[model samples]
Target: MTQQNPGSAPDEESPAGDPWHAFGYLVAGVAMYGFLGWLADRWLGTSFLVVLGILLGAGLGLYMTFARFNRPPDPQSKQEKN
Candidate 1:
């Protein structure tokens, strides 16, 4: 007697979900790392740490984004739905 809405699956990704989420992650990572690097440069009187931090942040962000978004969905979840 229970009816499920055809469009109500929780596993479905909205059309704008992944890309926007990835973009937000990348921007936040870059800004946070860059700010930390800038602080380090100010404290240590060095000129290179800001650039390094930005690069490291970008690399890490990209790695995280791809790792999270590019993987296939879990097989167990699919089976459980049925």
Candidate 2:
């Protein structure tokens, strides 16, 4: 049997994968929505849309992060591996 490296992990279970993905989702969501909100605020001459946009972005980001990283493993794939 081949041995795994002590410091190595499979891609699925890799420690370096999830945090960066989550952070990217969050930052991208916030940046995108925040920009939209700022634009809306500017157009409407209002100040609250930016905050609302940021909140919405953050919520969506969290949702995406959870959805992506919290998935259940596929039984078919497991069986195939075995």
Task: Give the TM-scores of the predictions, in the order they appear.
Answer: 0.74, 0.77
Residue 46 C-alpha lDDT in model 1: 100
lDDT to native, each model: 0.81, 0.84
Give the TM-score (vs. native) of candidate 2.
Answer: 0.77
Question: What is candidate 1's CA lDDT for residue 33?
Answer: 94
Put down candidate 1 lDDT per residue, 15-53, tens digits, no spaces: 424688788878888998999999999999999999998
Model 2 spans > 4 angstroms off: 1-17
- By lDDT, the best candidate is 2
After superposing candidate 1 on the true structure, give the runs of residues whose Cα lies further than 4 Å from its correct spot: 1-7, 10-17
The residue pairs that clash in candidate 1, if any, are none
